[model samples]
Target: ETFVSRMNLESHPDQPEWLSHVNASVLKVKLAMAIIGISSIHLLKTFINAGNYDIKVLMWQTIIHVVFLMSALAIALTDRLLSATHAAAKAGH
Candidate 1:
């Protein structure tokens, strides 16, 4: 909103006043995902430092990878959904 105002750009007719709040929410979600990714990296590093090939260690590693992969897939799906919505809106349909 500030940038748009500063640039003297007109806002979209359909754009909600709450759009800034929505953007903040999206930023929070992205930050959380980033923290999760960083934590997963550290977790894997910790598992590696254990230097063990036991069943428990293997299970932990597999679980971590699965969780991270799922989160990534979820993010991708969400992005696609948002992109599609934006495209539809832009097409004025």
Candidate 2:
């Protein structure tokens, strides 16, 4: 791909890695997911108390939110498990 070729050419071969790559990628997803989760809670609450929105629309929205939020949750959960395993290996029990 063009993007990959450009990055490979630009990056120095001796470049030392930093934490930004992981932090930036993970935190971006985390923040997005947090926002989605809050929105889902708000939507569910509205449907519960107000009962003004159409049931079909609400159902669709809830399903979408669940799917999106689940994706974020899955990524975060996997990261945590991997980190735990890494720590355990480092600790060497």
Candidate 3:
């Protein structure tokens, strides 16, 4: 409502509002997935490459990595879903 009521591009290519909305939705999802995937991979490689540590230290590091990965993944996915919901609602279909 705000976009339509406030952003009237009467002379710029005449693109439908839905196109802009869907593109924003896709961009958001892609940006989120990229960030999450890269971060997860980087963290995994960091732990994997940290070899030769003592058993106790390694176990602690593993536990920490698992907890962090799960937390980050859950938060990212939840946000992705919420963004999609907003994008769909904006489409007015």
Candidate 4:
């Protein structure tokens, strides 16, 4: 429900003051984290049923999991950088 409200707030043109307090970068980071979590679950399930899967399938799942992790890391780092830059700019004003 909160996620849906946030999405609606982002799309609305007439945003309230509270909307300004909600950082979009934070939302992006959260979304990335959710993706990583889902990926991890899928990878874990694959590992548990390893005998049922081909070697190539296991390898691809691992590679995909690594990619999801890397993507999440990148999103978090980028959000941190943007937040720092915004803070600096505000301080300079």
Q: Which sequence of candidate numbers ranks them by TM-score, best first? A: 4, 2, 1, 3
What are the lDDT scores of the predictions, listed in order? 0.69, 0.74, 0.66, 0.85
Task: Name the regions of candidate 1 deviating beyond 4 angstroms.
Answer: 1-29, 52-54
In model 4, the runs with Cα more than 4 Å from the true position are: 1-21
List where candidate 3 sits over 4 angstroms from the true fold: 1-52
* Evaluation by lDDT, superior candidate among 1 and 4: 4
Tens digits of per-residue lDDT, candidate 1, 1-90, equal 455533332476765575544564376567667867786786677677766567787677668767876776677678778878989999
- Cα deviation at 21, candidate 1, in Å, is 12
Q: Candidate 2: what lDDT?
A: 0.74
Model 3 scores worst on lDDT over the 10 consecutive residues at 1-10
- Per-residue CA lDDT of model 3 for 1-93, tens digit only, reads 345555666567876766655654466556656666776676677668667556676677567666666765676677788878979999977
Per-residue CA lDDT of model 4 for 15-53, tens digit only, reads: 787766657777887788898899889999999999999
Model 1: ten consecutive residues of lowest lDDT: 1-10
The TM-scores of all predictions, comma-separated, are 0.48, 0.51, 0.42, 0.74
Off by over 4 Å in 2: 1-22, 25-29, 41-52
* Root-mean-square deviation of Cα positions for candidate 3 versus the true structure, in angstroms: 6.5
What are the per-model C-alpha RMSD values against the true structure? Answer: 8.0, 6.2, 6.5, 6.7
